[model samples]
Target: MPAFPRHVSRKNEYRILSAMLLLLHLAVWWDFGSSKSRSLLLAHAGVFLIWQPFWRLEKRFGLKDTVLFSLVSIGLACWIFFCWFVVLIGLMSGFPGYRRSGRLVYMPILFFLVSDLLIGCVPHIFHVKALPPAVTTMFQYGLLAVPAWVFIVRPHPGGGASLYSVDLLRAISASMMTGMLAVASIAITYHLGVDYPVALFQSLLGLALFLFIISWLLSPRMGFIGLAQLWERSLMNIGTPFEQWLAELAKLADQQQSPEQFFEVSFN
Candidate 1:
């Protein structure tokens, strides 16, 4: 067997992180009766699971495939949520009238959830090469905000529509700000609780604050530039050969033209 490279080891580290996140999510769901908490945890698991495949796809097939998969995954998630909403409505409406409707609603969400989990496992399933630093970091950090926002802020009371806006820059800023607030609030809560470990709370606070600052500084710019570059690179990868061939053909055309004539004449 061939020796495993250092990069493969690093990729495995991400895989381990993803697995731990999944386990934590399931544990929380099992222990908590809070529907909001469970939904938040599920969203976190969904986004975290996506990062592995997003990175691996980008490295292997390039940015276009990565973006395509991300979009499709998100679309499926939206469909799943919609289906869940319909089921909840049907169940609340009651009885045989809504029985078939409820079943229909339940099936799609279950499918999407399973598909999302499998997609998340893609990094471990396929042994692709490591991506460039910018590509890796941008995808990882950009996606990190998804679960953070969904879990900590969006489903919470007074989370605001601004947090879920489609504007990329605004969304990135809101994610960072809300994440910081969540951390600050958690730290204060721990401090006020006599039984809680102050040292651990402080350490978590410091880490969260550090990440908040970094995201605030980096995310919007990276989101714009990185996505633009990714798209540009994808297009270039597809276009460069054709462009060269056109250039060569132009050269051939020019060479075949006589200096005295502006246009080439052919005898048939």
Candidate 2:
């Protein structure tokens, strides 16, 4: 028997790898029982199959350094996913509080992940230029409406008492809307006419960035109300420091005034 050439052996190895990947994908879909598990698997697939290639595009043309840049990209992606996963676990596990609070914390993450999955699949149906405006509008409106409906119609476990105030609700909605718009804008700019896989990943990244910013701005106001409530805690904390200082000075002057003196105080 003749020995196979090196090139032929490498080709065979690649074919086997491709076949294995296909089989694994089939198995995942075939035994899909839980939506949560399916979602996690889909997210993993989207990252590896869709996003990784987009990051490797520059390498495809030899226009940029591939190894070092790819490594950095992978590292950053890993860090972000790891941190998000940790936060997600904490939210689900009831870190600071049990029951209702934990559910409230987890709700946004669940909403975002579902939104991302929906947006990720959008590129398969729509063009990038056509995407941004529609996406922005949907997010702006959806962000505003969804939570309001959820709060009013499907209030948390405890009751409607823990529901958000109108101003806070509006702010949260605005922030989410702004974020979705940003993501759509970035996707339209970066992946103008790319293939479906590359475009999908770009759009996903844009959505993720938009969501991150919105959440960062709105989270403190919604759940951690301490920052917003700081000034309103007491009447003294409500006024400017300079105003309080002036009031103190006026009090001192009034005390120093002599009861026997008939001094005329000029009014400005």
Top model by TM-score, which number?
A: 2
Give one digit per residue, the lDDT tens place, for model 2 in 1-268. 1223333222332233233233323323233324443444444443333212123222242325445545544444322332333332233233223346435533553454334323432322243333365764574345443333333333234322212222333334444543454345545556574544455456567667876765665566567565445534443455667678777667656865663332333221
lDDT of 2: 0.40
lDDT of each: 0.39, 0.40
Candidate 1 to truth, TM = 0.19
Candidate 1: pairs in clash: none
Candidate 1 C-alpha lDDT tens digits along 38-60? 45545654444333322332234
TM-score of 2: 0.24
What RMSD, rounded to one decimal, does every model reach? 20.8, 24.7
Provide backbone clash counts, one per model. 0, 0
